[model samples]
Target: MSLNFNKAEFTRSAAARSGFLRDGRPQFAFAGRSNVGKSSVINRLLGRKNLAYVGASPGKTTQINYFLVDQQAYLVDLPGYGYAKVSKAEKDRWGRLMESYFQDEGGLITTGVLIVDIRHKPTADDVTMHNWFRESGCPEIVVANKLDKLKRSQVEPALELIRQTLELREEDRLVPFSAEKGAGKEELIRLLCEACGQ
Candidate 1:
C-alpha cells in the first residue's frame, strides 16, 4: 500500500542525540540555511498551515524536529544554518549536533532534501550543506524554493544557476518550488514517497 503523507503529524523535537527517534523507520531529512523557507516547504508538503512552525525570526528552529507520516516514515527537520545573529558558541553547538546526527550508526536517514532560495545564487553555507549531504552517502534532492517570487522567464535561468552553483549531477533532482503557491508540491511528495519506499 502507498503511504499517505497528508496524515503527517508532529512527533518530537530533539536537541541532543539521545532524544532522536530510533524506531528504524526510514527518515528523510531537510537541511538548509535560515530564512530559506524550509519550514514553509515542509508545511506545504504535509498540507498543513503551521505543522513545521514558520517562524518570524530567522534561525528560530534550533532543534532537530521529527514528523511522522502515516506512521510509516519520518520527516526530519534539521536546524536551519547560516544565520548571523547567533553567537559562535551556539553555532558550534549546532555544528556538533548536526555532525552527530549525520554520523549516527543507526542509519536513520534514507534521503536528504536541501532547500535554497530560488532568486539568489547559492550561498557559501548552502554549498557546505550540500557537500555534507553528498559526503553522508545519502541520495539528495535539491529544492529551489520560493519560485512564485520569480518571473516566468527567470525560472529556467534561476534553476540553471542553482544547478551549476550546487554542482548537481545530471541525475540529481533539482525541483523549482514555491511553498506559498504550492508549485512543485506534487513532485516533492512523489520524491518523498520514493525515499520512504512507498
Candidate 2:
C-alpha cells in the first residue's frame, strides 16, 4: 500500500514540552542541509503547492512540522540545519531541538530521506547527518534532488561519491529525483511504504 497523503496537519512540538500525541504509528523523517528542497519534496510527494512552504530563505522552517497521513504514519519535516548567515547561537538551539526530537521515545524514525543537490555532491554537513543516521541505526534513503538541472553524465559520479561517503550498502537504493518533473516519485513512494512497514 502507498502512503496516502491526506492532509498536512500541525502537530504539537515535543521541544515545546507538548509531548508526542500519537503513539505506535511509524514516522519517516526528511532531513538535509538548508536550501536542499526539503519543503519542495514534501509538496511534490503530496502534489500540493505551498503545502510545506517553498521558501527562498535558507532557514525558512524553524519548527518541526508533522503531517499525518491516513493516521497510520507521519511525514516529519524537520528544520534545515547548516545554513550560512544564521548565528552560532541559533544553530546551537537547532542542534538541541534536533537532539531532543531524534532521541524522543515516540520518535520511531523508520526511514530517513536525505536530500542532496545533484550538481554539488554531499556537503560536510550532509555527511555529518548521514553518519548520524547510521549511528542512530535508522534505515536511510538518500535522494539526489534536482536532477533536471544537472547533466546526465554528471549524475552517477556525484551519487557514487555520496554512496562512498555514507558507506551505503549494496541493498540500499539511491534515487535521482526531480520534483519539478515528477521523476522517481513512484520509486520513492514504494520505498517509503516498505520502510514504514505498510
Candidate 3:
C-alpha cells in the first residue's frame, strides 16, 4: 500500500460526467467549501505549490480535477461548494454535476475526503456534501483545514463542533490539518494509502 506522494501529477479535469475517467483506479475525492483553502490543502498534500490550481478567487474551480499519484491512484478534486457571489444558475449547475457524479453507480469514487475550515461549524452545504459521501457508501475522511489559524485552546472545541455538525460516525477519521505547516499530513497520507489498499 505504499505510495509516492511526491510522484503526483495532474491528469485531467472533468466538467461533466462524460469527461470522468473510469479506469478502475482508486479515486480519493476531495471536497470543500469554495473559500476553505481546499486548493491549498491539496497543494500541500501533493507537496506542490500550484499543481492543483489555487484560484485567485473563490469558486474558480468549476470542474472536477483528477490527479494521478505514483501512477497508481487518482486524487479526485471535486468542485468547491458554497460560494456566495455565484449566480443561482451557476450554483444549480454545480449541484447537478455533483449529484450526477455521486448518483452514478460505477463506483468511480473509492474514498471521500471532505475538507472543512477548523474554525467554524460545518455549513448546510457542507452537511449536504458530507451526506452525499455517506450515501456513496465509501470510506470517508474529514480533514479540518486551516488549523494554523486557531489558538491551541480553541482547537478541541472547534474539532468537536465539526464533529457534531457533520455528525461523523465513530469510525470516521477526522484530521486536524494545518496546510501551511504540513501538520497532520502524514496521518492523512496514511489514510489515503489505506484507501488504496481497500
Candidate 4:
C-alpha cells in the first residue's frame, strides 16, 4: 500500500473543546508519554519535520492537536499521559481533556497508535490506555519507537512484553519504529492506510 500525504496542518485545540467533535474523517492518533517522539513520529509519517511540533520539554503540548493529512484522515496528537513538570491542576485539566477525547470523540478514531520507547518497557499509563482501547473496540497498533536506541535482538522481547501486558492477539502487529532513522516508516504507513481503508 502506498500513501501519498500532503502537508500537515495543526489545530491549537479541539472543536467544542471536545477534541474535535463533528468528525472530520476517519482518524488515527499517535498517543504516548511526552518526549517519546510522538510528534517526531507523526512528522516522519508525513515526511515533514515541523508538522507536529516536537517540544523541547515535556508538557509543552498542553492541548490536543489535530493535523489534517491528505484531506482523507486526521492525525491526532494527544497530550502526553504522564508529565512531571506540570502542576496537578494542569494535569487534571489534561486528564479531563483526554477523557472527553477518548469517550466522547471516539467516533473519529479509526485506529490509535500507541508509542513507547524501545529502551523502556510499557508503563502503567500505557498499559491502561492499551486496555481501554481494547475494551472500547477501537483498532490499535502498538508501536515500539526508538528501536535504533536498542540492539536488534532486544526489540522482540520488549515487544512481546507489551503485547502480553496489553493482551494483544496473535494477529496484532507490534511494529518497531524509529522516527530518527526512518525505520519501520513504510510498515506504519501501510497500517495507517489499512486502518483508514485506503
Per-residue lDDT of candidate 3, residues 34-77 (tens digit) = 99998999899899999988888888788889999999999988
lDDT of each: 0.90, 0.78, 0.91, 0.78
- Where in model 4 is the C-alpha error above 4 Å? 15-19
lDDT of 3 at 66: 92
lDDT accuracy of residue 58 in candidate 3: 88
All models, RMSD in angstroms: 1.2, 1.9, 1.0, 2.1
**Model 3 accuracy (lDDT, Cα):** 0.91
lDDT of 1 at 86: 88
lDDT tens digits, residue span 1-198, model 2: 457774556564444425544577777788877888878888888778877877778887777777777667788887788774678887787787777777766656778888888778688888888877776778888988898887889888988887887778998778899888878888888898888763
TM-score of each predicted structure versus truth: 0.96, 0.90, 0.97, 0.91
lDDT of 1 by residue, 1-198 (tens): 257878998999998999989998889999998999999999998999999988888898888999999998889999999873889999889899999999888866889999999999999999999998898889999999999999999999999999999999988999999999999999988887777673
lDDT of 1 at 135: 88
